[model samples]
Target: MTTLNLPVVVSARTKWIQLFLGLVCMASISSPQYVWTLLTRPLAEKMGVGLAELQVTFSLLIILQTFFSPFQGKLIDRFGPRRLIAIGTLLSGLSWVLASQVTNLTGLYLAYGCLGGLGTGIVYVGVVGLMVRWFPQQRGLAAGAVAAGYGMGAILTTFPVANSLAAYGLEHTLWLFGAIFSLVGLLASQGLKAPLDEVTEPASRFVAQSSRQYRSGEMLRQPLFWLMFAMMAMMSTSGLMVTSQMAIFARDFGIADVVVFGMAALPLALTLDRFTNGLTRPLFGFISDRYGREKTMFIAFALEGCAMTLWLMSRDNAVLFVLLSGVVFFGWGEIFSLFPSTLTDTFGSRHATANYGWLYMSQGIGSILGGPLAALMYQYTGGWHLVFGCAIALDFITAGLALWVLQPWRRRFMQQQA
Candidate 1:
């Protein structure tokens, strides 16, 4: 394989540099999905669509980012990181540039939805896959660090994007930022290469627990993969629902414009949520590294479920709502780190990218249900209570599955393979 022939740079410091490069690449692509909420209202008005209809663009972006990830992952494995990620960076930037000129729904969907989705998917899966191989001793933390980039990268740009949209025309803002995203992302991607074997072969739970390397086909055949898929899909549904719908819900609840500490409540909540979301990945991933994956997952998932319930109860209180949203994200965002690390632990790292690609499809399934479907639920039910209730239910159910079912099943599956 390419990994074997790649020059084995034995220095541990170089691998950390690779991890940072991957982080930057991930950050470059994150705004497409993470900041989509900011564009929803203006885009809806400009395109003459309802909130639900406008959300379809968000759904498509996620669907393409996740659904096509397996192929993108496999390609990264074949072609190496630098080439593929550079292409993804350029495509992501171009998507926004193309989006700047669009006057209709079809054009918006094509540029922002299809192109943006594919581009971000490529960078996301590719960088994540690279991290797993590069830091074999700390797979969970490595994954979490890069995933944190995606979760929090928008923090630097959220206010800027919001301000630019208001101050300049949306088209001008999109074009200017798109150019920067493309240039910066491509430059970061150039620093990425497959890790040498010396860097990738450190002893870890991922290597310790797995009985054998499983190919993508074999991984698909295992019942364990499907169970993880279901759990991930459920988790993704709850998190994505909150992520895509939060701005709308805040507005509807009449707290979006309410200010605390001289800042609008909704944006402040979003900023806090981004912080918690980024923090949780490495926090919980480090916990899982020491305490076992299932235990950490159980705790975090239950926290999200309870946090959602509290958020709904305090809906009218802007301060509580803002605080609780951060709590909810703190509980939810770690799945990006946890699930991928868990999957590699079970299946081994030879096909890590491809295996994760299949697992990532659950996120796409979730984006469909969580983004547009959740919005539709609000439209039909005349309130967000029902939507929040459904998400809470899924959260608890998945938490139960993670603790009671996944732990035992994976243990047995690995034993049998051994």
Candidate 2:
């Protein structure tokens, strides 16, 4: 491409920057997961730790997301996302380097749990918020696209990072990861900043607060918001719980035969799962655009709830596989995109990122508790029956909460107020 004048480079970059930024942001966020598989055995053996001790990193990671999301959101409002993401990415690289030297669990916690988690919160907010701004017309799709990048990061880095580990060992692998983090982060961040006009415009001065411009704080006060939160949390409780334990669940329930049945198609199915999730967000967003964003959210919430309900009752691998696939593909897909768009419905365009940021933070809280809750239920009952049973209970509860949000009642209230 021929270089344009000074203004043109900036203009060209702004329009296309989200794609680049999204990729890097996702790469850094996904590193922890690869660490989950490749590093698990070596790190545990070297550090003399158990599975539970190592697993604390996951809970702590989600907990940090809860703490840092609002702060990152605020930073996006205060300073443009460029600096926040760049700095966060750099920190993550350094954390990996530091993690490489750690001989104890405490050091691992500081390196991966604290630094990795905080850095991701910063970078993820920036990339995702950038997508929201670029694709205001398709909130679900945009959400899904950003999420898909994040989820897929491991796939991209897994092989390459693993190759490095195979040659260098775990200690050296951490340093190599740090180097990748620093270089990719710095390079990727070059495209991250918004145009100056967007940066200079103060967010609050532009807020159209005539009841529609919803502030995150004010959103918390709305009964509708709580209901929406419940829907996401409840549905996610099952979807994520299953996701956290999919391989083990598959083994326990005789999933090998069913998965083997799809062996020829499994790779395609995984791609389909990711693509369907990514595409569903945008497709659902288009649906919301035509029908009504709130109603779209309600429907998505109900679908997700039902998916969990089905999973909870199924014993056959065939049924389990289908429901699990659908839940992640469409069930969570629906909510992932639906919630942000609904924020626009309730709050209008002004505070979509900030408002939605707080809403998504609810997921972090639910994620932390969901795993242990499911595990405890299994410990006592020795199967997924009780855990999935709780999912069914929450399914209706969340659906009811969703109905209160942008459904008939919320609609009636808005009409009367209007």
Find the candidate with the highest TM-score and give its number: 1
- Candidate 1: global Cα-lDDT? 0.88
Per-prediction TM-score = 0.96, 0.77
- Runs of candidate 1 with Cα error greater than 4 angstroms are 1-9, 197-200, 205-208
lDDT of 2 by residue, 1-418 (tens): 9965442223434545575576667666656643454566577788887645666666566667556787787787678777888887887677788888888988888887788778777776666666655554444456556666665555556556657777888888888878787778777776775544333222222111124666778777877677666666676665556555544455576653365344522233343454555556657766765666556666765676676666555645554565465455565656666666565556655566566667767767666666556655666777877766666666566666666644765576456556
User: In order, what lDDT does every prediction score?
Assistant: 0.88, 0.63
Distance from true location, Cα of 365 in model 2, Å: 1.4
Instruction: Compute the lDDT for candidate 2.
Output: 0.63
**Which window of 10 residues has the lowest lDDT sum in candidate 1?**
198-207
For candidate 1, the per-residue lDDT at 231 reads 95
